[model samples]
Target: MTNSFINQWKFFYPNKLPISHCFRQYFSQFWFRIHSLPESKRYADTPAEYELLLNRHNQIIDDCFDSNASIFIVTGHYFSQSDNNKIYDPTLRLKYEFHPEKEINLTQANPENYDDDEEDHFYRPYSINEIWKKNEHNDLLKKIADDEVRAFMISFEQNIIIAPYDGGIDFIIFNDAKRNELINKYKDWLSPRADGL
Candidate 1:
């Protein structure tokens, strides 16, 4: 299983280093735990459903590549409130390409010498709200949610997946309660700007 996953990663990211063995180990362990969850309680309704979701996600990725969009995989910490009044330490989470073109890496450069155009491939942290706002006009997201695809909604909140049609009112996929908290927190920051295609 680990080898297979690594092979797939290599296939997708031929130009980059393969995911580390340690990260693959953790990914395999997590996959087992997630796969064991009951069908109804799990993220996907069935194996087929999961596969369809994955296929759509892959297609969007392929489109990005074909369009020469700069892709960056983002990894960072996110704050979540605990039961106690005190705030818990930031939890590690991974998000990818909330806005692919806007991920400007500036870490290696001195602030005095910063140049936006020269550092366009670096990964940058974006708030959940920002990601949500960006998704509003994301062509990939809209394409995934098209009626022909039967995807009622598409989301970029935590993971990239198209929600299966459930025969109900179509709604934005990222409107869940936890995401609402993040949106409310960042609502005052800035209005979402449309990305230039």
Candidate 2:
């Protein structure tokens, strides 16, 4: 992260977090990416995901707001590659922007032992996108009888945007008939593309 962006974060988490926290996030992401290169004939590429990326995200959020969906938004970024094992913008669509604050509800987020598991290092109850996923008014969709989440509302500053971000992505196991129907109907838009979150 740049100094300007670091300075900007102070406005968001004033006393709880420090300026260095911002640096560690972007820096480590960039650093690890540098070390995790595929040495061979690799190059840059455009985002394989089309507008469907945004569409799928919205769909899951709609489901979560409905309170019946168990899906969690899992976001992954793809980067281009180089022969020298260096991952720079010149060769990849690296995760330049990670919205850790996007998701439904993350109040239960906690990690007991990260040392034993690398996945735990980035562990959270929700996807990395959820900025703040706790708003009661989102229950409107849950009570409404609809096969799909056409549209919805939330209560907060810029509730329309934040509500979705707070909850990462919709993750339902499809244990019953109703949710199974939803998955089958919106498979094209709901199925995750080939990317890691």
Top candidate by TM-score: 2
- CA lDDT for candidate 1: 0.28
lDDT of 1 by residue, 1-197 (tens): 32232233345434432212123233322211111112222244565664554444344333222333322232222221222221221112122233212223333422443554343223323222222222232333323223222211212223222222221111121335633443354333222333100
Alpha-carbon deviation at 37 in model 2, angstroms: 23
Estimate every model's Cα lDDT from 0 to 1.
0.28, 0.27
lDDT of 2 at 153: 24
Candidate 1 lands at a TM-score of 0.23
Candidate 2 has what TM-score? 0.24
lDDT for each residue of candidate 2 in 1-197, tens digit (9 for 90 to 100): 33232233345334322211222243332211010112211221223332233334445545434443222222222121222232322112212233332221112232342334433222111122223233322332221111112111221222111112211222322224544554566554332433311
The CA lDDT at 138 in model 2 is 33
**In model 2, what is the error at residue 130, expressed in angstroms?**
7.6
Q: Please state the error at residue 25 of candidate 1 in Å.
A: 37
